[model samples]
Target: MPPPPPSVAGGGRCILSFAALRDRCFSHRFLAAGLRPLAVQLPVGGREDPHTTVHMWVPASPPRNPLLLLHGFGASATWQWYPYLRPLIAAGFDPIVPDLLFFGNSCTRLPDRSDIFQARSIKAAMDAIGVTRFGLVGVSYGGFVGYRMAEMYPDAVEKVAMVCAGVCLEEKDLAEGLFPVAGVEEAAALLVPRRPDEVRRLVRLTFVRPPLIMPSCFLWDYIKVMGSDHMLEKTELLYALISGRQLSTLPKLSQKTLIVWGEQDKVFPMELAHRLKRHLEGNSRLVVINNAGHAVNLEKPQEVCKSIIEFFQEPAYEASNEEKV
Candidate 1:
């Protein structure tokens, strides 16, 4: 809870990072929903990633039917996962929401930024928390990490739900005009916005209908608080993500999978969702939310939450290769 970064302190004006206060409010809501904050140290990471700190919002009581919620690349999980926490808890699943490395209170001295590494970090944190097996749901960037977790630790990961993750994307997709952005540099800039306009552009791309008015001051406050830290590391993560990725190389998960997408998603597009379904293991199913864009979870929280709950409640998919709104 400090003033905005130096970038926003010009003109001798006083500005505070409102995002901190917002996070505090979210924390209280989480506490009210029977969850508390816990920071776990990751020592399993080799020399470069020693003692990486991963902060998690976990159940105060022992978790029953635990579900790990991984957030997107930009904001903290507290902001993104706040809406679903109460509902998930009420549905008899302990929602273990964790801030991915470089977001919120999670950080590391390590240079590694691959989704595989991120998956490993989160797994180590789960191990420390005494969770042997759990369901996992990841959104956007978190979906990528969740996929890796399911692939790497099939025994520990019972099921997976991914929101707007471009799992079918290949390195050549960008060059072949798959995304609105020309290339990785532009993609990274919007994903990790530094300027107010970049933040607006990101919103426009992520949402089907963005807010009518977003003040410059507030956007600057958001950048300083939510996006100013570990910028280089985050950019590197994007590059590392798309470097040599291909559908053939991407491992299909053995666990049951749920792929959710915004019907009007500009970020990953609906085409990718169908492609993911056709290519991923036959046990997977896809759900498309109408009138929603890339940020489907935020725009269609109730629908997304309902789908997740129903999917997890069942032991296995009743039908395979399904796509429903």
Candidate 2:
């Protein structure tokens, strides 16, 4: 990637730092896409101490159909949704990307770590921003939150799109060889990498074809910029997801859903995609992208965006023809 944007300082001297430069780069991209950052504070029930602060990207002008983009575990919303902004905007959709709690600038002092709590917080954030009804697009871990959001607030969530999110995964799936990792702990380590080698492993697992040789320096830089935050809390989130909920316990959603999966996904595997589609039954459409992995948005962004745009634009009666690439 290009060099990070120049860091700015309020005083006479320039405050040059890696963190500042990375923040500037993210801000520049968000502003370039006509998105302004807004921070909303959510007061947790029965908590008088520290409340939750959620940072989100909102359109400069009031958009017609709002689209909520929820990022996965690794990076923040900026890194995940920046690539799809142009296409989403061109398609006449307002994209609202938010950082999940303990990721990026979003944090909560609430004791609850379940996806239900996440769903509540996200709903609160949307309500604070005056988004009454919107479409939801979530990738990976964000898919869990999205599904919960759709289930809890069916009136608020219109259409749903889950990108490689194993919403149907049960605790038994881990020990049953559904994933490459042995258990949730190993998966968590790979997902939330602290070291450069772990980041490489994550990339290898996420992409259909990862770079054969990536410099350690570059990987370290990425880990420094994106990989080093709320490590323990992230791990807890994973554990809560696996242990707190199961496939049978999940509530069925009435919204028309789009299930997109990478043909070579190793994290959740393609089987989970089919399972999720089955769970949604007649209300869902499945799209499998060839040669892509868990990070299909980054690998085949155009195809993914096309699938989303088509799904949202096409009438519900025409969704019987499932598309595969």
Candidate 3:
């Protein structure tokens, strides 16, 4: 086999950074789709002493009903939501894709790592950008934040679409064999992988059928670019998610909720999706995409986007009638 492509020289060393090239390509895609990058600084507790900065992709002229796309634990907003933007735009929706705190350029100096904090920060970002009433589509960890946004500000959040988010997961779910991993620590390690093997494990768990022979160098490069940042804080966020909450105690959201799950998701299984639907009582709809796993949006973007557009476009009265039926 031939040697790898020429390494890009940076910081006085040769580095093969596919992620850097991918990020440039993602940015170009966003530009081509008519979305511009915007960064806003949100005050903590309405004070400027310490603030959180959020990075987002916004339209030049906002649409009447804006949609916010929140990314999961893996790559940033661009990599996760770029595929859905054009479809949403064509369907008469303005989509704002924001990198959740610690994912892209978004970060907070505050000690809080819960989804509540993330929700508030995102809300502040939207408010800064003059988006008061908008819909939300969140996948995986982002679904957790989107759920909190809907719960905390029901009127402000119009419609919610969650993809493979285990918001109803309790601390006990680990020992009960709900997840492929044994416990929180193991789960964290896999989710925030620092090694090539761990990245492979994550890929296996995330997709129904991942690449069978991912090169070790490629995995290492991915971890170096994507998985290296905010490692400690991300682990804290995971712990905080389950530490103070239980499925029974989770609040029932009032907004019309759409839960999209991969049929073969091992991370947050189909059982969780059904339970989430029932948990939301009469306010939720569940869509299970066949032959997909945790990263359904990436694996089956067309199906996921179609379900989202249909759900969001359905009239309120018709939705109510369907629910009744």
Computed on alpha carbons, the lDDT of every model, listed in order, comes to 0.84, 0.82, 0.82
> What is the per-residue lDDT of model 1 for residues 258-282, given as tens digits with 9 covering 90 to 100?
8899999998988888888887657
Residues 1-79 of candidate 3: C-alpha lDDT, one tens digit per residue: 0012233332332265776788788889999999999988886656643457899999988668799999889777898
Which residue pairs in candidate 3 collide?
Answer: none
- Cα lDDT for residue 238, candidate 1: 93
Candidate 2 residue-wise lDDT, 1-325, digit = tens:
1122222333332233454466678779889989999998875565422468898999988867899999998777787777799898889888999999999899887678899899999999898788989999999899999999999999999999999999999988888888888787987887888876787778878887777665555655666677677888999898899874578888888999999999999888888988887787777888999999898988888999999998888776544556788
TM-score of every candidate? 0.92, 0.91, 0.92
lDDT of 1: 0.84
Assess the local accuracy of residue 267 in candidate 3 as a C-alpha lDDT between 0 and 100: 91
Clash numbers, per candidate: 0, 0, 0
Model 3, C-alpha of 46: deviation from truth (Å)? 3.7
